[model samples]
Target chain A: MFRSRTRFRAYSLAASCLLLGVSSSALAGDAPSTIDPLNSPSWQYVQARYFDGQKLIFDDRIKVLAPTAAEDPLDVPIMVTSDGIADVEEVVVIADLNPIQKILAYQPKRASPDISFRFKVEQSTPVRAAMRTKDGVWHLGGTWLSAAGGGCTTPSGGSSGLWQGHLGEVNARIWPREDKNQRLRLRVIHPMDTGLAKGVPVFYIDQITLRDDSGAELATLQPFEPISENPVLSFDLKNVGPVHVEGHDIQGNTFTATIQP
Target chain B: MRNGVIGLATFVSVAAGAGDDYHLQPVPVGDSAQVFVGKTEGFARGNGGNIVNTGFIVGTDGVIVIDSGPSRAYGEQQRAAIEKQTALPIRQVFITHAHPDHFLGDQAYSGIAISALPKTIAAIRDHGEALSDNLYRLLGGWMLGTRLVPPDHAAQPGTVIVAGRKLRLIAAQGHTDADLMIFDEATRTLFAGDLVFFQRAPTTPNANIEQWLSTLDTIDQLDFQYLVPGHGPIVQDHAAIAQTRDYLRWLSTTLHNAATRGWDIQEVMQTPIPERFRSLSVLDQEFPRSVTHLYPDIELNVLPKQTAAKHE
Candidate 1:
């Protein structure tokens, strides 16, 4: 089993080299360059599948905050912030080696350039956040995080129906930022099981939609099982007046909440 | 020069917290033995779980250190502190268990013969990386350059002469599947390892309560003037063993009863702390974690019995 996995990884490496238009000899040379996300076949596939021919520029201005090693792989908190960039079109988060690599992509509507979210990390892998500017150039930033693995495969601690009573319970708080923007933080109770765990099957919240009091969709979120149990997300809200959140799980259970400021 | 600057910056970040600083001040136990009792603190980002107690016995020509602390820096400080009092070289380091706090520091004791049970060596080999990663997250920069060092010698259950002093290594299984208890024949001092935790609530994340209770009984039978536990203060009386035994019994009973009644884990966690255990260090923090670890097993055990009873 281990030998096959190693062989598969070697094949992927060779395939990645071929796809990135780089010779294998260049990869094995002295003074080898640092790992670039654009050179990764996974990132290339994400870009081709999501952005459709958009040019991505490596930018250090797009700051990302994540631990070099995660204590609990089930809930790895990450924050992505960009400065000196104008007219952001979308921000996409990719866990380069995850089974479902494209974790989240945010098309901000009247929101700030900063966002914080938590997701499950499968193993030691690179976590990338790419910001698409108004000119259609994708600026990418990422960091390598080391984990003990099995975050997605292991059974969640709440597997014994412990969360049944608290499912869909929502806690919403709004804090005013210094720049006159309000940060909307929402925590919903759900066990985002990844089905890889023994006997857990795939139970997770599949979608969440945020709307204003007038029923206008403010933003939509499509989350996967990799999101931590009792999912919490924070968004910088520009026009905040009695926001309502509606969500549905893979089991077809719908959850709704109202936040008044 | 740049590397030196980066190293200095890392050291400064790690040393910024006075509470997390690695300092071992040896206090005399019994007549000739000395012990360094670490603070009974919980695992945090700052402290890195440096809460286990370690001690040393000065023999005729050298010293035998019991249970290295939680990190490389801790073991280095411990070695320095031992050298401050005696000029004897550390001949052998005895690891009490496979827990990261007890064995991770083996990296600092370079060239010394580090010893542990065969199971402990296997555990260190299997789980050491995961444990190190966990410690890295907890200690951050404090765990700089710390790596897992496997034991060089197998500490079998027998007496071994170290520097003309007879040291008895006994295999005790309860607190962990394989625990080593060291006894100094010259001083009548027993290093009880994690088999005993005094004043502080004992952590049983990897314990078998019944086997641990039997091990406690075995420890009670040993002839010792002074007892050094894996955590908290030294023990002078046999009654101290009862504290850990009672807590284990209470925890097991609580978990079993809750499981039999089909109560939720949150409800079981809400089981009020006994008045006697309220003053134990880190009780509030560790009890819930212990419940989380042991309750699932209890539920599994009881669920099968319940089904059998219903069929009967």
Candidate 2:
């Protein structure tokens, strides 16, 4: 449970920019990409693909808690959350050395900026969470997870039922703490295949939506092949109610479940 | 790491003349039994896959073998060693379970009556090759010429007289889907298979901790004066059985608690062992593996309900 964190900073940057006679009122700017502590070879490419000319900071405000070594790379659980960064707009999960770099992206509309999910690790890689705040700056937090590799390429034949016949089976539960903190955990049965194995094509859950009883969006997830087979995801919600989960795999199969908190 | 398939042909040629390289010395257990205890460690080129115990019992008519060793070399030498003891023909060979250490040696005993529980046979048929390839990666030349050979017959659980010796075969699960424990009524000896590991961490890749614990109680009740674990030294009393049970209980509880707290695998693996379990051979190496095998389920089963259970 070793943690690395950075202090959320500089709301005064905007006020200070005015006195410095900057051209724009916006205070946020691209932090140096050289702050790569993990120093993954994929850093330059990852920055170009996701953050691309946007103001970014590879800071610790966005905290990513992951295992130091992936015991079962097929389902390595991770927790991503932010500290003082408020009004987050987007959260992107990535494993720099994995064959599939971008694992998933989450948009928590009415949910807290906290999520727990499992993902596949191809090898030793720096797993990261990039949170884009409302101020238009992308902040990244990452931890290194060493693996024996091949979690993505090898078809984990362990859960065949999740793929063959019951591709859309859903198991969901709403956990309501006495302190009014609500956590929703759901699992959708799918292979989440990366098309890396012989005779197996890319078949995976690509989009997931959590909505309230009135059908308003609670949060949305865009999952890639790096997600574990029979993907299970958990989220901390801003409010408690009956939540509906609807999911669609890349093969067009769908699954849905409703849970009361 | 290099792939194990390459240079395998060359390794096989070197192994033929080296069949007796295991130096398999069977120690006398009782009046009728000889146990070839293996090293209490992981599979490696130095040890081959000879990290598992195998033995044989001499009945009046013939010999009943407990298990085949890890490779063709171990199995071939094991039969040779038995041949040195008695002139009786080998009556039956029992594969304790489908784990590679217990069954991969079946090739050397071709034409012999090799038997196992139906599920064990199925598991060997299903995952045997993959498991063999795993050892090939570790031991390389030591695993030369080793091939997957599934059991020839399905063993029924009951009292059966093999080679004029009354044997009780108990079918159980927990260590794996199908584990067979053989009790020799004549000598009051029990071959516990991998179901019991004394002074060594239990492997849990195919274990259900709760079910395994329950099965241990069943084993404790067996009226055997001598116990032979699939690994580690033989015991005269229930000390080895109790050690295995105590270790498994602590392992399950630790993992359950860790998962309930949402601790990632590294945190769980880094957990310190108690003073009691420190005596277990290779606990540092094997404990991490057990955590890897069982922690995923712990997270799935405990993560959601535990918070509510603790705070409510």
Candidate 3:
């Protein structure tokens, strides 16, 4: 059993026959959401690399929701929400087995712990979200997203100077929903190229900062190359009116946009 | 004699999987255009990649084949089926685009002048082998001995006289980089290959959403009564054009908004498809595919940008 467990989790999902042209909706009905004990073989490396060989506890406080299979490996959207985890300092997402792991590291200062964004996957693997509480405990949660594999190794369709004319353009919308909840969503036009594709450089958005009109920080996200091109990030805010989206690409070109409610 | 004939026929059927037969039937459109309506499904072994609409126009002097079909076998069988309808010699073949479904069968029309838009011809020349190999994988034995054949003649936009019939070749783009729509003036029939899909969801593997939407409007303005689509049913009214436009517009708008709203691929896929388009054949398969092909770019365009902080 341990030997079988050592194989890549995505390879196991691939063997389960997800690619015989079965419509994704059909496989979606089955729920395999909960798996225990940090089951992935890459967990050791991830723990040593990101968690510093520290003991991490599996907790329900951190939740991850993603599609069972990635239709387009370059843009697999995922949501990571924390429940009953108070004083959370930061959340780090990792896709075990991806050549380039550490999808993104998020610090939710003024926005809700709930966040949704897109990422790239090179293959089927365990995607985990670990939230560190103020007490220094790392709470982990994740799911297995099955894919035909090669979300990274494959050349990105949007990487061919596709963003040349409109590079650095930003479109944002901040609206208030009922019950006083304000939603913040925006997209930045940049290739976020993984440099995995031939003749392509490793350029991507290094960081994003959301702030209120007064220049007070809302939330900051550090996205890696696995983030899809033109990274679209969404967050729910407890505050209201005039949110500013700010960030820059790897080339040191910076940009800023403000959405008024 | 009947027993001997039956025995020979049985022998032919026994060679099944050797790319022997397409068993095509021509459905008459208006006065002279005969369309071979294909299955409302993607390429599969059961359909032998016969999921494309190929037809011919029978004129006073000769016949003009609209498209070549999917494989050499389909093209040969299409020719046989056309022969059963008229004695006119096959005069000209016009390809709509370079998509494998539209022109892979050109191998069978070797002697005839197979024509297409200049860009269409170049696309086939560049990607023909890869596309044909994919069909062989999808259809297995049905693709037996099939090879890619690019159109030899460059057909410009405007009227072309073929076999005594005046055809208005309308050049457009969107569904693919180069889409050629043929209008049979004599019959008031428009052979809109892949440009218009009726009762089936349009495939957008090579689409530019904004351009496609604009082209749909242009097609709606054309003067034609009968329409032959690349993959679905033939229609007399403008329902096909409407359905095609409605679906594409919704897809493009929804994808853009989804990206702007930071919705992921799964979220976009899970969003309920409007009930109006639920009945379209292959929507289930085509919807996801279009999203895969189009969503990333749509997202890239509308997704906000963070640029160099402005001075001052």
Candidate 4:
């Protein structure tokens, strides 16, 4: 009996590690420094596949603020702020282990140096924000968040017709920033369902373009399924003007709204 | 790095005693009340987020358990502990709410009659599997062999005589859509489940703060000398209820203000927790969760009247 119990315990531990999808080495409590994104297999793949073998500098100047553990994996809030890094051109958000690892690639123009958004976290993984400065260097910072998994895989609790009447609806609000520049916040109603969710095939807004009333593209956002349901995006715009927001989902359903200054 | 080491240390310790390992220690709270004060801590694999307080009352004829606990193993251990104190059979198990920590342990008391409010029962039936899956991922080995077991008896808001003791079941909403507060007339002790969190931050993922605040007021007026909260230490006075009420009110107002100011969720997160709450355990963890749960509602409340009317 004792031997069988011991064997069962061993099997349980191994199965638990497999179920959690975390290697025993990762759970063995090594120093955080040892868990560098550059060394992680997913990050390495992302670097090579996305960055064309460019070197990423580990910089503390870029801060990624996320909860150590997500209370709601479906909408884990994340904030990325830079210490006024000069000539910062863009910020790329990545969930290293998500089925769709690339969440967003944001190009900030006259926007504040800080950006905050909510996204889905499939599991406990390292979330990183890589800031590309005008000098062509990628500064990377990240933190590990432990989650229960299934933000991407589980069927949402809402009824199937939840978005029938609300699809593509957009609400925009513009507020003055401290520097007198106006901040444009847009909220679009969409399921953003990842194909990974059981019983729910892939349905998501693929591309969003913010255009001036005169048809000039102000910004274009390529969002993946990992974007939270009812996607909300914020940008800092100088001298507000009437703008139009347009997007289409994977099913080719079109949505459009006009934002007036 | 420090946190990682600590986590590993806890895992090691838990693994060292893999068989028949149970950490709950029950202490007497009142003349007849005994509470198993769980580790006053946050969710971690080591503790399995079994941070809830489960209690029982031993009367003339039998014993009545307050909450079932977090897992099958926990419930089994709790049963064993209670047996050590009394010879009376566990007549019935009262589940305070539908949260996994409170009802998932029903499997351990298979032969015993398990009871909960109708809504709580429905919630457990509907969300139990999902909640168990989440807990299994979080607690790992501790949740091994745990399964969801729906309550067998539907408890209503009225007096039920168990073991010849008058037990008043009060229906409450806010902390959850269905929260039950059990008041024992015989002992003058109230088992305030998740409705009252003392010294620890209340988990608000399912809370309706407005309803919860009003529920607190109702609980405060109840006639009870001893109070057992779902997550924290036992209370002798009404101060604990006020503390919870204050926290909920402050949380609601803060979210409202942040929404009105058009603050991003990050800015709301950065808002300093009041000095009064700085001393509460798990504030760092539960505060952000509360914001995430309430911010969207707050934002909806602050939307331009015309825009909001249109969406509806």
What DockQ do the predictions score, one after another? 0.02, 0.09, 0.24, 0.16
Native-to-model Cα distance after best TM-score fit, residue B144 in candidate 4, in Å: 2.9
Give one digit per residue, the lDDT tens place, for model 1 in B1-312. 224434653675556655446756899997679998887887665565678899999999999999888888788888888999899888999999988888878887889899999998888899887777666655666667778898889987999898678999999898889999999998899999999998899988688989999999989899988889899899888756989998999999989987665443445667898999998898987786677567655754533210010100
lDDT over C-alpha atoms for residue A156 of model 1: 72
Q: lDDT tens digits, residues B212-311, model 4? A: 9989989988989899999888888998898999998898888898876777787788898889999889899888888888887777554432132122
- The DockQ-based CAPRI class assigned to model 4 is incorrect
Against the true structure, whose lDDT is highest? 2
Per-residue alpha-carbon lDDT of model 3 for A1-261, expressed as tens digits?
343244335344643655565545544543323224557877656765787634467887677887665766778878887875777778899999898998898888877777888888988899999988778878898888876456776666666666776666776666576677687777777788888877888888888888888999988889898988777777877688888777877888787887777
Give residue B80's lDDT in candidate 3 (0 to 100): 86
After the best TM-score superposition of candidate 3, give how far the Cα of residue B183 lies from its true spot, in angstroms. Answer: 2.6
Tell me the lDDT of model 3 at B61: 95
Task: Give interface RMSD for all predictions.
Answer: 16.1, 10.2, 4.8, 5.2
> What's the true lDDT of residue A80 in model 3?
87
Per-residue C-alpha lDDT of model 2 across residues A78-147, encoded as one tens digit per residue: 8787875788888999998888888999998888777878888878899989988899988888888876
The DockQ value obtained for model 3 is 0.24
Task: Tell me the tens digit of each residue's lDDT in model 2 across B1-312.
Answer: 334363763565476445438888889887998899999987767787788999999999999998998888789989999999999999999999989999888887888899999999999999898788767765777677788899999999999999999999999999998999999998888999999998888888899989989999999899998899999989999898899999999999999997665455555777999999998887877887787788777767753321110100
Weakest 10 consecutive residues of candidate 1 chain A by summed lDDT: A29-38
Complex DockQ, candidate 2: 0.09
Report fnat for all candidates as fractions from 0 to 1. Answer: 0.00, 0.07, 0.41, 0.17
> Candidate 1's residue-wise lDDT over A1-261, tens digit each?
344344335656766887888887754542122236435546445554555545666788886666555645777767777874778878888888776676777767667656777788888777888888888888888878777566888777778888787777776655555555566767777888888887888988888887877888777777777887877677776675777778888878878877765
Residue A237, model 4: lDDT of 58
